[model samples]
Target: MAQYSGFKQLLIYAVSMFIIALSFYQWDMSQRKQEERIHETQELRKQPLRETCAGDKETFKHRLEDVRNNELANLIVDDKHGIIYCYIPKVACTNWKRVMFSLTKDEPYPDPASISPDLVHLPNILPFLNSFPRSEIKAKLKHYTKFLYVRDPFVRLFSAYRNKFQEHNEYFYQRYGRHILRLYANQPDPPQSLKEANASGMRVSFQNFIQYLLDPLTERNEPFDPHWRQMQRLCLPCLIKYDFVGHQETLQQDASQLLKILMLQDNIQFPPSYENMTTPAFLLDWFSAVPLEDRRKLYELYEQDFRMFGYKRPRELLDG
Candidate 1:
């Protein structure tokens, strides 16, 4: 806790480099979505293709791009105080960066990466939220607002599997070779359930996720790594330190309130503008893409997240 008691102070004083690392990562992300998975391996086939608007590739691509390019980047709301935005993967981070960089009132130097190390008191990239840890640091926020955003678990998990693990793409394929799911018509497993395929680790293969899932059992015998079973355990402990929790399911509304908390009420609105607003249909498709059995596992795994954030379990979303 840095002591500002406002969002602006947190942003202005945040470890800006994490945001830069995030931004830099996104620059490479644009191409990932459009590229074909023709060169995929066996494990890459564990998940199926996202449910588009009846195969509306052009529309889907364009809309996703719009969200990534402008909507996400433009959703910034100045808290007018030093703010710390602990970014969660694939949760509209780009827009947050654009917003943070635009703080004209008492903004830091033009370059954020340079100042981020000092602010966060870290010397390297965040690696994973686990190793660096957030719990031990919240007590220090007495001077600044400690904030982080969360998303609907179903939405977030589906987006991750549907999108080829966005930030973790290279790792997913490289580690799990034949175990991961791909879009290839000839894939061995072809987007099967995690229970069936036994996916876990974070390795470049689908097996990584399976191994990751099985890591808990491993701890009694071995330890888990590159696995959600392990990573979730690692990060769950850190989540306790977060003082501000915003939900991604209600981005526009949540972000608006966040800005107000930081004293930027007049400068922003609830539900920031998304130029190509996604229809409720897309939201439905997004949830429906995942297989029901796998979804139940995911839902159970993320039950804490769903329950903690007040997310209503849409029966359609669950059974879809």
Candidate 2:
């Protein structure tokens, strides 16, 4: 009876071991399949961007030399990690700047939130790709992982208007606000100062801002401001190949994936993005004041950006 019991115990141990091994194999296969799915998703995003750049002959020069310095200035370079990020204004850039700041530090990087948002934007706090020599720039472009985040064109424009005009921003007021108010707001003699403007309740309306963009003279004189500039122009996606193309719509997922790709996922974290009040749903209401012809013209201006970044054309706004 004792001998029979010992044999039964051995058989049970063997069965348990087999089950454990099978579970490990199944888990590993699942992980691999998940990774494959991720790779396919990334390819879907990148392939179209490449095709768009290749197809557009007028806008895409396909050469870095044709790109000007101010344009390249948007690219923030991190030599230590070999990462280059092209930051667009109003696309969670403040938080992204903080992440870049943390990566620049030594091992056990500081929490991104701990860094001052304003300090990162201050000149010389972080190195820009444009600041490097021509040879260095070329080398970094070839070897480093390049990425940029984009947003819905119309939504970005509205956000820019709300932040610069509706808010009390002294510099924007002096630079673009005053001009927009004078020309579009029908305020020929708008307040000279932001404080004065706020006190008198004089601000540029959304329609006025759109009119400024559609105006022939706006581009004839100078390029659009960086805050309101098209993502294509700011990042030079055609000339510089970006490894990862993130959108504001999927900021967190894209950011997390990018950090993992860089092998910094373990060392750092992307800050939580605040809720964006401006969204596609709000586009119709905001554009209600804008004329149909002007809306079409605005779309035409940013058509390259929409196509390049894979954002669906705003048919709702344009159709009307």
Give the candidate number with the greatest TM-score. 2
What TM-score does structure 1 among the candidates reach? Answer: 0.44
Candidate 1 runs further than 4 Å off: 1-82, 97-138, 165-171, 176-178, 181-243, 264-292, 317-320
Candidate 2 lDDT over 181-268, as tens digits, reads 8888889899889999888877788889989999999999998899898888888887888888888888898888888788888999
Candidate 2 weakest lDDT stretch, 10 residues? 274-283
**What global local distance difference test value does model 2 have?**
0.87
C-alpha lDDT values of all predictions: 0.43, 0.87
Model 2 residue runs over 4 Å out of place are 1-20
Clashes of each: 66, 0
Which one wins on lDDT? 2
What does each candidate score in C-alpha RMSD?
21.2, 2.0
lDDT of 1 by residue, 1-320 (tens): 44656776667667587788788889768536423321131113111112222244443233221332211211122234555555555465545554555453253324333233223223322222223224423323334565555555555544555445434344454444344343222355543333323354322232233333433443475432222321223223122233456556566665665675677656533324354344447756654544566556656666644544455665665664
Model 1 poorest 10 in a row by lDDT: 41-50
